[model samples]
Target: MQQSKGRPRTAGAGQESSAERLDGHGREPTEDAGHLRYDDPWYDALASGWGESAGAGEPVPAVVAAARREDESRGAAADVYLEVQRSAAFQEVRRRYRRFVVPACVAFFAWYVGYVVAATTAPELMARPVAGAVNVAMAAGLGQFATTFLLTWAYARHARLRRDRAALELRWDTQELTRGVDGGAS
Candidate 1:
């Protein structure tokens, strides 16, 4: 890295390089922006430096020791999750989820594609007036939006009514198994 005589000096050991700090649009990242979404399920807090660093890196020998320990712990944790996943309770919950989701997704896709096919292939039918200046195309287009909301509501309602309790119980069971407090805490 060649230092340009005219370039501004940046202090290390305190902050990342200004070039690295800039966002995709060449603008600096805003501190006030809400980056973490508590409501979101897909947020990766560990990878995002939310709480702390990956420990045991200060000493050279401890890093090697920690690496061995980490590998063992990871394998054991993986096995526990794999075991829980293969359990009948987990399978039942998954089955219930799939039972509702698969059919609902298929039906919704069919409905949407059917509408598109009707609009494109059968223009005369779509153009047929339902009421004063309100054609079948308009009605069907509106039906698409209606069905979207209907399906969303139905999915949520079904999950809450049928699967939520069983899924919650399954989650609790998995958590308890993973806690491993009896001299086996990983």
Candidate 2:
């Protein structure tokens, strides 16, 4: 009986030979069991920086410098963001948004809860026929849907009228600050 190279082959081993197990790369398996030789040309090309700009020699230093510049720019942008956050205009915008949202949420939730409570505790009030089969409950439920649509329209109108222009100006200012005169980070 012929013996396999390195370790002895166990009984009922799969059909793949040692060469096939090396991923068909034409490289032999190393003396260390389960380790294959790194012979792929693609990895070698990547290591040598193939297909990159011919003028830019040695990519590591350039990559490091770019990363350092990016970090510094991010730090500067964070400072700008903080300044914007501290500004009265930003504060006012946020305040207005919260002012509208908080009260609206409270009012809507109260209305919804009131409906639920009335439905549960006041069956006679809900069941009283208005015209034919339509009752107070049905009308109130339909009112809830109408209220949702109305609130949505009102919020949109409020944003368009009171908030959109201010927000847009703030965004433009922020962009100008972050990107300097030449459209690059100063």
In candidate 1, what are the lDDT values of residues 1-186, reduced to their tens digit? 212332333555355554534322112346665442222233223332222222422211112444556567667667778988898988887898899999999998999999999999999999999999999999999999999999999989988998889888877776776667323563
Report RMSD for candidate 1.
11.0
- Candidate 2 TM-score over all chains jointly: 0.63
Worst 10 residues of 1 by lDDT: 53-62
Which regions of candidate 1 fall more than 4 Å away from where they truly are? 1-64, 181-186
How well is each residue in 6-117 modelled by candidate 2, as lDDT tens digits? 2334656556565554532222456786554433222222344322232334322223445556667778788888888899999988988888889999999999999999
For residue 128, give model 2's deviation from the true position in Å.
Answer: 1.1
Q: Give the whole-model CA lDDT for all candidates, comma-separated.
A: 0.65, 0.69
TM-score of the candidate numbered 1? 0.63
Note each model's CA RMSD in angstroms. Answer: 11.0, 13.4
